[model samples]
Target: MTTVLWFRRDLRLHDHPALTAALETGPVAPLFVIDPPLVHGRWASPNRTAFLLATLHELDAALRERGARLHIRLGNPTREVPQFAREAGAQRVIVTRDYTPYSRRRDAAVARALEALGIAFHTRRGLLVHEPEEIRNATGKPIAVFTPFYRVWQTLPLRPLHPSPAHIPGAPGLDPGEIPTPASLGLPRPVDALPAAGETAARARLQRFLAGPVCTYAETRDRLDLPGTSRISQDLHLGLLSPVEVVTRARTLGCDTAKFVAEVAWRDFYHHILWHHPRVLHEPFQAAFRSLPWRNAPAHFTAWATGQTGYPLVDAAMRELAATGYLHNRARMVVASFLAKDLLLDWRLGETHFMRHLVDGDVANNDGGWQWAASVGTDAQPYFRIFNPVIQSKKFDPEGAYIRRWVPELRRVPESYLHEPWTMPPSAQEAAHCVIGHDYPPPIVDHTLARQQAITTYERARRASASEPPTQADR
Candidate 1:
C-alpha cells in the first residue's frame, strides 16, 4: 500500500504534514510535476524558477539521506500525476494544499483524474499556519478586512509541528529523474544576486534572525539602509521553510516578536482574502472602484520600470530590484505608491512588473500590497492618503545611504539635496558635480501635481459610481 507524495510549493522535508501522512500509510513514492503552464507562463521569472530548481536539488539530496528519492516528470499535473501514481503502483496521493485560482483548478482536475484511476487523493494544510476557511467572522463568512482578520487570526491555535520522519521507505525500482536547468525550461540564466536556496540555508537564516534581529524588528524593519529585516521571504515563498516553524520560533523570542508575528498574520490575511475573492487577481477588491479611470501613462511607467524616474528613493528601489532580484520591504511601498499614486498608472501593471523581477513574488501578497497602495482593496489605505516620495525618502533613508548606494550619480550631491536633487540651483548642482536633468534626470512628474490629480481621479470615479445604478456586470 504505497502512497504518492506530490510536492508543489512545499519543497522541504521538515515539518511536512503531507509527507508525514504518506509515510504513515506505507512506503512512499515522492513526485514533483513540472507543469508546463507554470514553467512557461507569463508570471514566470527566471530568478524564481532557478531558486526553485536549486531548492529541488537540495530536496532530492535530503530525500536520499533517508531511504527515498524524488521522482520528477514533465507535463500537466492532471495527466502526469495520475500516470506517475499508476506507474508507481501507489494506492493514494497526498499533497499540501494551495489557494491560488490556477492551483485550485489544477488540483481539482488532478483529483478527478486520480479518482477515475481508482486512486485516493488527499490534501493537507501546510501552506499557511491555519487553513483559509478556519478563520472567519462571527457569521462564519471570510473576513475581508485585515485588522479584523488579524484579530481573529490571533485567537486561532496553530497545529502542533510535525517532525520529519526518521526514515522514508523508498518505492523500489523507480527512476529518480534529473531536475531541469533554466536553459532546459527555455528561461534565461538567473541573475547572480539571488540568495542561496535550500532547506538548510532557510533554517540557518531563521536561526540567525532569531538570535538578534527579531528583537529589533519592531523599530528597524522599516529602515531601508539597515540589514535589520529577515530576508527569508523567498525561502517561505518556495516553502523551503514552514510557516509553523517560523511562527513557533518567533513566539519564544519575547515581546518584540509580536510585530514580526503580526507581519506573518498579514501574510495569512492576504491569502484568506485571495482564497475568498479570486477576482482580486485581475480587478479591484472594492467593486465600486473597478472602473476607476487609470491614466496608464506609458512613458512614465517605462521610466519607473527602468529606474530612471528621477525621484531618488523610487529610482533606488527600482534599481535595487533590477540588480538584485529583491527589494527592501519599505522600499516596496514607496515604489508601489509612486507608481500608483504619483504616476497615476494602473496598479496591475506595477504588480505584473514586480512579479516579473522579484524572486520572492507570491501572487496573493503582491496583489494585496499593490491594491493597498492603490487604495482599491479590502482594508486599503484611504483614497486621499497619498505618499510623498520625498518625505518617505528622508524619513526612512534619512542619511540617503540607500539612495546613494543604488543611485550613484547622486554620490557627489550634498546631503541636503540628495533626496530632492531636482530642487538644486544651477550653481549648487555644478558645485556638487551632479547637474539636475544631466547627471540625473529631473523628476519625471511633480509630486505636488500628481497627488492632486490622483485625488481628483478617485473623487470623479466615486461620483460617477454614486450617480449610476447597480448592474450585474459590476463585478
Candidate 2:
C-alpha cells in the first residue's frame, strides 16, 4: 500500500506528524498543491508568495536528499488532490490540519472526494501546539478572553516531538513536477527584502534567539529601536518551525522563557478564537459595537499607508512594513491604534492592508490584533484608552533611532522634537533643514481631539444599542 503525504502550511520535514504517519503506512508520495485561491485571492501578497516559492524549493531539495521528491500540482485541491492520489495509486492521504474557515471547508470537500476514490484521508494536528477544542472554559465552551485561555493552555501536555525521517522511500517511476515562480502565479516578483526561507534557516534563527535575546524578551520587546524580538514569526507562519519544537526547546532555557512562551500561546489563543468564532473575520466580536460609526476617511488612510501621516513612529512603522514586510510588535500596536482611533477608520481597512504587506500575516492573528486595537474583540483595549502616538514614540523609540532609520526626512531634526516635529519652532525647523509641511507632512489629526471623539462615538453607540430592540441583523 502507498500513501500520499500532503503538505499545506506545515512545510518542514522535522517534527511532522502527518509525514511520520504516512511513512508508517508505506512508501509515501510527497505532494504540494498550489491552490489558485491562495495565489489570486484578496489575501495574496507578493512578498509572501516569493517567500513561499523559495521555501518550496528548499523543501523539495530536502526531500531529494532523503531519496524522495515533492510532487507539485496546480489548481483547486478539491479536484487535484483526489486525482493525484488515484493516479499515484495511493490508498491513503495524510495531511496536517488547518483551522481557517476556507481551509476547513476545502478539507471537507477533499475528504469526501478522496473517500469516494477509496482513499483513507487522515489529518493530524501540527499547525498549533494544541487543538482549539482541547482548551476550553469550565462551562465546556470556548474561552473568549485570552488570559484565562492562556492559563489553561499552560497546563496542557505537549505531544512528544516526532523525529525527522533519515530516508523517505518513494513509489517507483513517479515524475516530480517543478516548483513555479511568483510570476507564474500572477504575482509580481517581490521587490522588498525578505528573510531566507526553509527549515535550516528557521532552526538557525530559533537557536540564536534562544541563546540570548529570549532571556530579556519581556523587558526589551517593547523597545522598537532594539533587536529584541525573536524574528521567527515568518518561520512559524510558513511552518518552517513547528510550535511544538519551539516550545519544547524554549522550556529548557528556564524562567526567562515564560514571556516568549506566552507570546507563542498568544498565537494559539488567536487561532483558538478563530476556530470557535469564525464570524469575527467579517464582524466585530462584541455585538454592541457592531454598528459603531467610522469616518472611513480615504485621504487619512492614504496618508497612513504611504508613510506620510506626519507621526514619526507611525510613519516609520508603515515605511518599514513597505520596505521589509515586517514590523516590531510595539510598532504594530501603535500604527493599528492610530488607524482605528486617531483616524476613526474601519479596522478592517487596516487589517486588509497589513495582510497585503506583511509576509507573516496569518488570518487569525492579523484579524484578532486589528479587532483588539479597535476595541471590538474579546479582552480588547477599552475604547477610551487610546495610544498617544507621540508618547509611544518617546517611550519606545526615545532616541529617534527607529524613526530616523525609516523616515529619513526626520534625520536632521533634533531628538527633542523628533516625536512631535510640529512642536519645533520655525527657526529650529529651518536649522534642521526640514520643514513640517514640505519635507514631512504635519500630523493628520490632533490626537487629543481624536481621542475625545472616539470615546464619544463608542459611548453614543453603546447607549443607542442599549435602547434599540434586538434585531436579527446584529451579529
Candidate 3:
C-alpha cells in the first residue's frame, strides 16, 4: 500500500518524521496544501509566504533528485487531501503533528475526511524535541514555569536524528497547480533579506553555527549588536532543520552547547503552554491582567508600527523588523516591553504585529513572549519590571551600533545621547547633524509618566481582585 506524506510547516526532506515513515511504506506521494485559511489568517505575512513558497520550490527540486516530487494544491487540506489520496491510490497518510488550536482542528477535519475514503491517517511528534504531554510534572500537568520545565527537559533522552532518504520512490503523477505568488493572494511581495531556503542551507547553517558561534551564545544571545544567537530561528520554524538534529549536535559540545539546547526547549515550553491553554491566544494568560485597561489608540499604534515612536531603541528595533522581517532576540524583548508596558497597548497588538513581520514567527513563541513582556504569561517578568528603552539601548547596544545601523539619522549623535536623542540640546543635536523632530521623531510618550501609569494600572488590578481564583488567563 502506498503512503502519502503531507507536508505542512515541516517543509524539508531531511530528518523529517513523517517523511521517514512514508518512505518505509514504499513509494510515497509528497503533498503540500496552500490552505487559504492558513495563508490569510491572523498573523499571516508575505515574508513568511514568500519563504514557504521558495522553500517548497527547493523541496521539489530535492525530491526530483531522488525521483520524487512535491504536489502543490491550493485549498482546504480536509477537502483537497482526501481527493489527492484517492487519485494517488494511497491507503494511508502520515504527517507530523502540529499543536495550535487552528492546526489541531484542521488536522482533525482532514482525518475525518480521510477516514471516509478508507485511508488511515497517522501523525508523529516531529516539530518539538519532546511531545508537550510526555515531559510533564509529577501531577501530569504541563509546567507553566520555564526553569523547572527546562530542568525536566534536560534529563529526557533525545531521539537520534533521522537521515534524509537516499532515494524516495516516485509518486503517481498528477496536476500540481501553479506555485503561489504574493500578489495572487492579495499580499505584497516580500522585501526582507530572508535566510536561504531548503534542507541543504539549514544543515549548512547548523554546522557553521555549531563550529564557531555557539560557544559564545550564552554571552552574546542577549546582545543585539552581536551575532550571538543562532539566526536559525527561521530555519527551525520552517522545519528546514530538525530540532532533534540541532539538540543532538549541541549536546555533543558540552555545557555551553547544552545551554543552547535548553533555549530550544524554550520553543517547546511555549508550545506546551499553548497546547494545554489555547485561550492565551485570545485572552491574557493571567486573569487579573485581563482587567487592565488598554489604550487601543490607532494613532499610537501607527506611530509604533511605522517606527516613528521617538524612542531610539524602540524605533530602531521596529524599523529593523519592518525592513528585514527579523529582529534580534534582545531587541524583541525590549521592543515588546516598550509596546505593552510603556505605550499600554494591548499585548495582542504587539503580538500580532511581530507575527506579521517576523519570518521566524511561531504563534506559540510570539504569544508567550508578548504575554511575558506584558506581565500576563507563564513566568512573566513582574509587572513592575518595566524596561526603560534608553537604558536597554545603552545596556544591550552599548556602542549604539545597532541603533545607528537601523536609525542612521542618529548616526552622528554621541553614544551618551544616542539612546535618548530627545535629551540632546539643540546645539549638540545640530553638531551631531541630527534634529530630534526632523531627522528623527520625538519620543511618542514620556517614559517617566508611562512607567508610573503602567505600574499603577497593573497594581490596582492585582489588588482589587486579589481573592479572584486565578485562571490560566492570569498565567
* Candidates in order: C-alpha RMSD to true structure: 1.2, 1.1, 1.8
Name the regions of candidate 1 deviating beyond 4 angstroms: 473-475
**Could you give the candidate ranking by TM-score, starting with the highest?**
2, 1, 3
Candidate with the greatest lDDT versus the true structure: 2
lDDT of 3: 0.88
- The C-alpha stretches of model 2 lying farther than 4 A from their native spots are 472-475
Better of 1 and 3 by lDDT: 1
lDDT of 1 at 133: 81
Model 3 TM-score, 2 decimals: 0.97
Off by over 4 Å in 3: 467-475
Instruction: Put down candidate 3 lDDT per residue, 350-453, tens digits, no spaces.
Output: 99998888888999999998899899998999999999998888889899889899888999999888889989999999999898889888988999999999
Q: After superposition, how far is residue 344 of candidate 1 from its true place, in Å?
A: 0.9
lDDT of 3 at 467: 68
